[model samples]
Target: MIKRYSKSMKKRDILVIAPQPFFIERGTPIAIDLLVRNLDNFGYSIDILAMPIGVSPNYDRIKIHRSLNYLNAKELKPGFTLKKIILEVGMVIKFITLMSKCNYRVVHAVEESIFWALLFRPVYKYLLVYDMDSSLVEQMVNRFRWLKSIENRLESIESYVCLKSDAVIAVCNSLADKAAKAGSKNIHLLTDVANLREQANIECKEDLNEISQNNKIALYVGNLEAYQGVTLLYEAARLLQQDKVEICIIIIGGSESDVQYYQNKVNGDGLKNLKFLGSRPVGMLEHYLMQADILLSPRIEGSNTPMKVFNYMASARPIIATDLNTHSQILNNERALLVPPSSVAFVNGIKKIIENEDYAQRLGSAAKEYVFREHGIDQFRRRLQIAYDTLK
Candidate 1:
């Protein structure tokens, strides 16, 4: 473990409390990585307190500290579960302990971590930054129907976190608007950039070769949550199977159990065109996307855009995404084929892309140009620095 409390320090320390495991190749963690790097570049000493569930990467300007282990589990996936609740409690205890020991200029809290920061605000003389990724209250209610009874309580907490924090850093414009409506005094819209370009050099694995050989391959990259529209993808695959147009649907990234569950469904349905490549290295994302004829974002519900969308756009692949606000904000009819959140609409969108090569080429080119022009990593860095400057 890296040293948590150092006696001497030249720069002002910024305490970052991440509710999830740090250094993981997920959306939130990846955003945290870029934030830490940029803050370090601007000369702020960062101390991150995260769950003891991820491998820490080396950062010159930041130190990663994990909470005390309370559960036998070591990995915490995205979304709410019993394991996540236990780990969150452990994180709260560790965060309080760290705040008691160190003097910080700012407290950068992500997701539920803002609640702990709020609790410590009375004693600590530091500015609070709520890194708003999504509405926690909405997420909880959406994930568990049982939690609907206590939604007002969750919303109250969320409102308090947003209103009380010195500033709110939103991942997308939708989140920024939500923060504004919640009475946040200052809101910074810091959108995410693509990581696909950086991951382009990794060599492709052998299992992917067969899928690449197909006449056309459609790729879906993300966790197989109910909200992600995995069922919709399967239904679309089944629909496409009837046509037998040599189009294969390849899914990448899912837990072992999720993969098995979906794999079983595919086998029972006898869908030969659907294949699952259970969780691969995140760095190989561009490698997989490069061989794809079309990329997919079949999310049925959400406000903030998925991190993969930016990479998909950057990949220069024709995208077939739902016509929800989450996707429509970044993608248009010229950049992607937007269909309603239904299997039939999704399949129709895919068919349109497959049948019209000229349309597909133009859409792909426009999408790549759009991402490169608007969502560059340099844009993220500049906006982040500007937000931090306001705190100073």
Candidate 2:
């Protein structure tokens, strides 16, 4: 990791407690980088405490302080893990250490990290900002059967933080409504935006060239977590193969472990036509996107909008997404084909898009127009400023 912390910078007004790795090709980091950029524009000196995994974002006003990775591990994935539980304790200790060095006025924390910020609020007396990305309780219990014991207590803790935090900055309307249900009087909705262009140093078209253009390509770009609906997509792939559908569902992101695990599972099931390529750089995104006939955001769990939907809309590709609140908050019937998270539903949706070229093109065009008009860096910056303004 590149050390870029500078003592020359002025006093930091905010301490952004990001439990995820920073500057990585994933959801939370991308949003955090954007937050740093816009906060710099607004002249807020900030300190971000994150895991020791990701590369530096390299902004001037932002000084990054990573919590001790005691296990000497180099990478971390999304979701709740025992490793994360250990790291949270380290981060809380680090947060306490930083309180002695910097008198931060606001503490902006994402996900479950808000609990630590709240737990020590009386001592430090910082204005707490809960950056609600997703429902942490839902994320844990929906995925892991082992977390059933503490599920109710987890929900209670989420409600407690929402109620006590100085402000709640929700990522979507569904999350904002959730915060309201928990009695958070000061709630702000600051949604995510799309980064359409990639500053790619290396151009990659080797993988796309191998595929034949005989069948239409449907691309799914994101992590291969179960919550991301990769398993659902695997089932969809099988149904399509049985039905002799002529579309290819190309997966473009996952950790090495996830890729290997899913590939093994697919091989065991004898599923076909679902291609798995490990995570690609953000720069190669447009190159890969051009080869796609359709974009997908098939999240089976969580209410917050998937970060891919913004780019899916911005990519001008006809989208086929789950009809859950996760996608429907941003996508409607006219914008994209919203269907139930099922194999038959995906198969029919793919056929409908394939059969009607004009309709597909219209959906793509409408989505692009909507994304550019509503979800862009400008709006993200404006909403973020409004949230911070209240903290002042």
Candidate 3:
């Protein structure tokens, strides 16, 4: 464990709490990594307490306490089931025990872990900071109808945390508005940031000259969840079947089940143009992004403004996204090709891009410029610093 004593009497100690271990490729892990890396620049020292759910080997410098020996179960059958209740209680106990041994100026809990911090707020002698990345309430309500009771309880827990915490950081304006409605006085909108320097360092070694000459590749780099609209991409491919436009949709990063599900869908529907490359390492993601003619963000109505969108912007690739509030906030109609969340619209958008290469290039250039000016790591670090400094 790397230990450091407080040099100045006023230097605040910050503890970042999350369910997933740091350095993972997921959005939350990426956010944690950025926060940790910018700690010194923000004039604070951070100790992390992350669940061992998806522990990564890259986090050697940060002190981590593993908790909750729980299995990854997909189905949600009931609320307050005996086994789940026991697990939740046990995890909370372990978290509190570990927290008791450490002294910190602020307790920064991310996502659902804010519920645990709220439960132990009275005993914890520090300012609580709730860093809500997504609307858990909205997600729970959408995912499981039977968990309405549990969802209400979780919402109450979140509301309690927001009410009690010294400060709150939401990743988007919509979430920030929700936090404000929840009575959080010190809510700040901290948009997702791209580690552009690292992404730019990825060498584009793939010889895309031949591929680029024949076909226009539209890439979708994210999980294969239903809300992500992967099926719509397949339908869009079907729509443009005989247009004489050679277009390929490359999907990267999804689980085994996701791969099988999408594969079956595409094959069953006889869509040969959509290719599933499965999951790739973070280093390879940039290469794929670089090779693409356009990036697609076809998310359905949900609380997701994926961190990958920022990476897409950083790649400086022409983007075609659904005309949703989340996408509109980042890639306004001027910077990206805005289409409705439908197969026909997506197909038309791609056709538009293929027809006007100059417009596509202009949009790509403008999108990259916007991202660097607003959503770069330096901007993220500054916003975080301001939020931390505002904390009592």
Candidate 4:
């Protein structure tokens, strides 16, 4: 018989320090949701101390605690900003207060919040688990070139925290490798699974009509952050129009501001084939996926796989992603088309997929089968169980 996490400690309680929103229709929060639910299944109670900016999870065995939001921030803007830093400070304070009241058996910190866990480990001495979502050092330096001046210092801090943590749960293989290189005592790989649940809101008014008889609908989902490389899609679409291949690019989710920003760019540039439908209920993602002829992941930064790729794979829609490690780790020439991170290369990829319908369908079918068999919720739960057992 296998050991159970609930029996490892007297309290069977965990303090989860999630630096992001508590409940959001995004990448990290969704992963956190699965963890919380699975821990509940294993008879563990969780107290989640999160940023005061999202909907409460309101689970049975979980209590949601929000940091003091002096700014009354309703929603945080994407990327690292002054606001995010202020929120981090607030989370640190709240974490300290929570720890002082009750002694949790485990302190599970996600992403950058691992810093606070490391700082307070000596005082509390709880089993510390670092949930490595992405390389914060890489994100900071890539988004802000000036951070390059102190990149080594940042890496040192990250490595030091990894070394101190009891266990590091990496979201991808690349992150697990980084953890090992940083001298982490224990490392576990737990990747995000596809969210394929469909919603009842089917009456979405999308202008995805193939204007010409030869038009194909290529859908892209997720925030329109600069790192997402949304502009690359535009550049590729412009080139495709020049070549007279009408690939109508339908962007499904993003902030209102990001939607306007990209919409303005497309409008001014006279790129008639691109459409932005703003943010949608993630449940409606399956509906859009079913309607899409091709899926696109054009992220230009970060090695961690985009959460949307799993959804794309489950949708049975052929994916065309950048040839970077971000997609290479999950995709290849066999399951999907991998092109260099260039507009010209994406233009060629789109043409090839559209020209040969049989090849595109084969790629989609293989991707769907692979993900369902190897990356389903059961696999996530098993991996998470094995990771938590390390604490014993």
Candidate 5:
């Protein structure tokens, strides 16, 4: 029989394990914070076991434990062979210890770390919830081609995790379908929506004047990875240079190599309108989004419905994104200008928005209204509650 815990149980505890600690100033950490905060309102207690990702100090919330030691030399490799063995052994030891010491009713694993939680579910008797946000197998193959064999092996491991887990939570329908195909029995689609009301209410708005007076400011947020199509934006900016349509393209985040590669392309090609802002804090991000006339998300084909898309909706900005299945699922054609993944198409989309103010406002208003109603945190909380309640 499946063991269950009551909501009124005096010692009910939920354990969350992720690669980063909760309350950190990053995407996954912020998502965990939202989950914990929402669950707390329902009188559920939480315990967290987190590994540090960036250089920030560990957060101190309810029953949170942070790992002190970094991974050894062998654990830092790209492939899953040696790293998987080490992670499995380490997680099993840590989970066994935690199980012996506490009375956790649920074990929630985020991202690729669900494999570790599945290893201990048999002995611990906890409800294992596998949170699948991104396609690990696709990411491995796309990013690291040399490790194709290792990536294929890791795909089986992910499938095993899904098959063994009691529940699976995905950030989108595409990811949910992938997990279900991999043998996950109970699957829930949980889109990554921003706390729009909170972001809209941010008091700081001084950066509005910083926008270049000569150009129509277009903003792009999120990591500057190759698949994000940052280079395409630069190319589009270059194409619009002599059109007398002054356009300023602002990029938010990317690695050093990514930054350098794009910077060289912009400078070498004399694309003077493009500017790279690197990464910014969340507060500043809201300001940037609010000050912009348009938001651009030229993502290539991938299993990603980026979190930044919600923020774009929250900002009530006319968005020009690529016509991909994942993006089309979240955003309607009426809400955004869904263009083919090409520089010429991107440039035309921007031109359409700039030349027609009423059309842009209509699209932006529809996007904001739709996202606020359908993809807010309240919706996320309801979905999560349903998933948790099913454990009984």
Candidate 6:
């Protein structure tokens, strides 16, 4: 029986198409790294075809092919950008050439790369695994308001990808539900973990007391997109200016332009409690997180949980996040303070965390425990294994 069962198992060769520049210490890239790392450990040979940017880390049984770089940009951030679209066209051509020559057991498409996988679906018999992080249509509409009229068309494309895929790896429950409704056969709700290998190793060079001027620090990580609720954070800071609490807002992430935009907004509002530390080294992230009295996730939209949320929970810092489904799924009143996406509510939440140290301590303790038990690397690996096993 063992011999017969073993006969069916063949060495797996997977082709992964990462739309974004690979090996970046960002949200989607980090998640992709975890998946690929786990698969490599299971003796799967992975060939990653990604944008010709980002650092490539060494991993056994893995090969990376970077697309031809036409643009001279050093970095490419997430979302729909002109350079990204241009690069994708080149990437798809390379993808086609690779698929024609290589024998892959499965094709793993990350986010927008699904369309490329779909383009070659008719020709290839390989299994398609969609690593669905966010709804492309939703993100497009959110970024470009004019695209709202064509939302249905975009969603139709999204539905097509889900229905065509053999397995859908959703980053959150909401995405899984959407995939289910779109007729996905195998939907795996594998959430993100706090993968901070580099960040954890960095030694702190600055003193927290000197950085915050002895004030209580509240940390906000991630990009400064409108959906990230950076505006709401600034609004809350303005409100906190008049309050008795001495909490300082330290934001870490964003392009120079985004940082300037928010800095001007904060200055115009006459708020002195906010500091925008734009695009710090990844190693510095843990240092700031460690010094923070509270971790802020004022995200106003999106379904998938932000990678920082897991990191925040693991930091044992009391979290103050919007009460929307995006955050409510991971956080509750016991583990975090859930507040509406409003300045007043956010101000109140901050006050609660600052004033009641006992409650905040309990909340932080609970959050850390929850992350260690549910959102660790082992759990992520096991879930990934189950999703792939079903395909076999």
Q: Is candidate 3 or candidate 6 better by lDDT?
A: 6
lDDT of each: 0.84, 0.84, 0.74, 0.85, 0.74, 0.85
Candidate 2: which pairs clash? none
lDDT of 2 by residue, 50-88 (tens): 887789876765789988889887888788888888888
Cα lDDT of candidate 1 equals 0.84
Give the CA lDDT, 0 to 100, for residue 104 in model 1: 75
| Cα lDDT for residue 111, candidate 6 | 93
TM-score of every candidate relative to the true structure: 0.94, 0.93, 0.87, 0.94, 0.86, 0.93
Q: List ranges where model 5 is wrong by over 4 Å.
A: 1-12, 21-23, 54-61, 71-96, 147-156, 200-211, 255-261
TM-score of 4: 0.94
Measured by C-alpha RMSD in angstroms, how accurate is candidate 4? 2.7
> lDDT tens digits, residues 1-392, model 3?
12344734334377777655444566677778777767754445666775545545454345565556575533222222344444455557667776666667777888777877876777876778888888877666666667676886877766777787788899988788778877989987898876656745555565443544456788999877777888888788888765656888878878877798878887898876777877766766777887888899998856647788998888888999999977887778778998999999999999899889899989988988998999887788778877876865
Candidate 5 structure quality by residue, lDDT tens digits, 71-98:
5422222223445445545655665667
Q: What's the best-to-worst order under TM-score?
A: 1, 4, 6, 2, 3, 5
**Candidate 1 lDDT trough over 10 residues, lowest sum:** 1-10
- The Cα error of candidate 3 at residue 169, in Å, is 0.5
Residue 117 CA error for candidate 3 (Å)? 0.5
Instruction: Write model 1 residue lDDT over 1-392, tens digit each, in one string.
Output: 11223324433468888888777778898888878888777666788888888889887657888887788675776888889988888888887777777777788999888887888788877788999988887778888989999888887778878999999999888888878888987899988897576656667665554754545889999988888898999999998888776688899988889999999988999998889989888878888888888999999978889989999999899999999988998899999999999999988988888999999999999999989888888888888877877764
Per-residue lDDT of model 4, residues 112-179, tens digit only: 88887888889987888999999999999988999999999999998888898989999898999989
TM-score of 6: 0.93
Better of 1 and 2 by TM-score: 1
